[model samples]
Target: MGVDIGLEKFLATSDGVLVKPPQFFKTLQGKLKSLQRRLSRKQKRSKNYEKQRLKVARLHHKIDNRRKDFHFKQAHALCDAGDLVFMEDLDYRVSAKGMFGKHLLDAAFGQFRTIVKYVCWKRGKFFAEVDARGTSQKCPECGGEVKKDLSVRIHDCPHCGYKTDRDVADGQNIRNRGIKLMSTVGQTGMETACADELPGVGLTLPRQVSQPRKGKTRKPKK
Candidate 1:
């Protein structure tokens, strides 16, 4: 499966499933702003200032934790959905500087992708990144150019008469690219091995290969 990440939605899969973004920061922005406002009015380095600052800090931390938790759950869900997962290889940091910068940063596409990759490894699913160029502009069905501006939400391919959500088309394109890349590298996508054993194979492996340690356990005295 291929995944497309965007500001409007957290991600849309090639399978046509759209996962709405929780936008944890945006949801809590008002409270965070109020806390910061209170912090600003406090005298610098005073007890009140310190207390307000910590409140603001805690709110920020809460947002981060919520976002991180969301990412992990989504990652695991993706791994569960498919044996192979693909995402566009793009520098989301550059996109974060645009008009929707705050939303993009809040979405944290890069961080989410990293979490997805790690989850795929842990769950024995294959994960890969494909070329990002023109994924949304090209037709997933006919490989024809279907030019449209950012305002366009639907992908109506004139050449192939293919219609679908724009993000879904992009996800399909990414999936095609990943499959092509795997073929180019001679991977049949059926290999089974631990991530450490065949890092480049990009196929499902046994679940026990990368099980994470659950807790810190003290060693018995010799």
Candidate 2:
């Protein structure tokens, strides 16, 4: 199923109201500052410049690897636990070009989804990706437009006083969209009655995880 990787938390209400711990953002800010400092000092194409560039690249690579590891673990766990998985038809080729482009690429949402779908396929589970149109900005309860700037993490509905965790609300909205899409095709989600009766969606086989060649181990085996 499609899931957004965000700081996991609970919702206080229906409207998405994000409440991030002070340290959470402070740590991110610190990392960004470090990256900026390193990036600013390096000359355009000198040897030292290349070295500094690699250093920054390694930092980003480490972050990306860690995030991917987590996503893989979570996706595997979900596949193990559920027989059906539904997610958004995310087109990262276009979406990864925004202000958060680099971060999004590093986060590897597309890769995570591919891994998840592959795992589902391997285990004979259902997998599907539906449209994600207006999933974030639209109110799930009333179908009203909830306009807010990117800086405004809190999704407060002045009309209904509804509030919730931003990511969680988005997940709920995504689930609704997936459900609607499925319904139009004469299908239902796991939450609906008889949803389990529907045929499992198709999935491609997951590629084998690569490893170093047989003699490549740094420590020779006894």
Candidate 3:
């Protein structure tokens, strides 16, 4: 599956699935702001100030934890949906400096992509990052350039008459690029390793090997 991360939605997959952004920080923004106000009003180094400071810190931590948890769950879900997953290789930091920086930072596209890669590795699934240029501007069907502004949410290809949601088309284009890349360069060592460990390769491990363990567990002595 090809996944296109965007501002409007958290992501859109080539399979026509759209995952909405949870915006964890945004949801708690007002409360967080109030906490910060209360903390700022308290005298420095005082007991009440320290308590309020901790409250602010805890809210930040809560947002971080929620975002991380969401990323892990979505990553596993993506792995379950496809054996091979592809995403854009663009640097999200550059985009985060733009006008929608706050929203982009809240969405945390880079972190989610990293989690997805890790989940794919843990699950013995194939994962690759493809060139991101023109993903949203090109036609997935005809491979022709179909230019449009950011405001344009739908992809309309005049050459091939292909039409679809802009982000979904981007996902398909990413998928196409990944397939081409794989065909041209063949599988990387990582992909080959993953393939070898999967069922069809005549190698099998315990079910727990492919599934993430829940809660905390102590490591056994060697």
Candidate 4:
């Protein structure tokens, strides 16, 4: 299976399934903003201030946990079903341009990709990062040029009359590239790609990420 990572829907598979965006921060915006306003109004050194600060921090933590859980579920389900999953190797630094770019960066696609890669290795499944340069512009069905703005959400190939969801078309291109890469490399190539690309995931087992944090220490009752 091949996948496209996008902000609208978290991921769009080549097979037409879309993992919907969680919009974690968006959902919590009102509560967080209210807490922030209340936090700002408090006396800096007061106990009430600290209490409100903790409440705000706790809300942030909740958002993070929910986001992580959503990503993990998607990764696990994809790895379970796919033999070799393909995805674009995105550069957040480059992609994070313009006013709202910081928001895009916070999506943490890099971290999600890392987790998915590690899981694939553990399960003895294949995963490849394909070049994303023209995957979206070129038509996967007919190899026809169908350049489009980000606003376009559907791919209508004038040449081959192939119509598909835009992100799904990108996923198809990613899958095709991965297949071509595997064909060129053969079994040895696949092994080399797995070892070289992931670097230590296959050798060093992945650690659990949900360990509990210890509370503040306290003196004995005296």
On lDDT, the leading prediction is: 3
| Cα lDDT computed for each candidate against the true fold | 0.90, 0.62, 0.92, 0.85
lDDT, candidate 1, 73-184, per-residue tens: 9998888789999998889889888889999989999999999999999888999999899998999999999999999999999987999999999999999999889886
* lDDT score at residue 65, model 2, on the 0-100 scale: 66
Model 1 segments more than 4 A misplaced: 187-222
* lDDT, model 4, position 64: 86
User: Which residue runs does candidate 2 get wrong by more than 4 Å?
Assistant: 5-67, 80-83, 187-222
Which ten contiguous residues of candidate 2 have the minimum total lDDT? 7-16
Query: What is the TM-score of candidate 4?
Result: 0.80
Task: List model 3 lDDT by residue over 15-121, tens digit each.
Answer: 99998899999999999999999988999999999999999999999999999999999899899899999999989899999989999999999999999999999
TM-score of structure candidate 2: 0.54
Residues 1-222 of candidate 2: C-alpha lDDT, one tens digit per residue:
334443233111122333321222234546766876877887888888788777777766666566667666766776765566666676876868887665555556677788888888888887777676666686666767887655666667666777765565566676667667667766434446564466894433456855447765587789
lDDT of model 4 at position 193: 66
RMSD of each: 13.2, 16.8, 13.7, 17.4
Query: Of models 1 and 2, which has the larger lDDT?
Result: 1
Model 3 off-target regions past 4 Å?
187-222
> What residue pairs are clashing in model 2?
2-87, 13-163, 15-162, 15-163, 15-164, 17-164
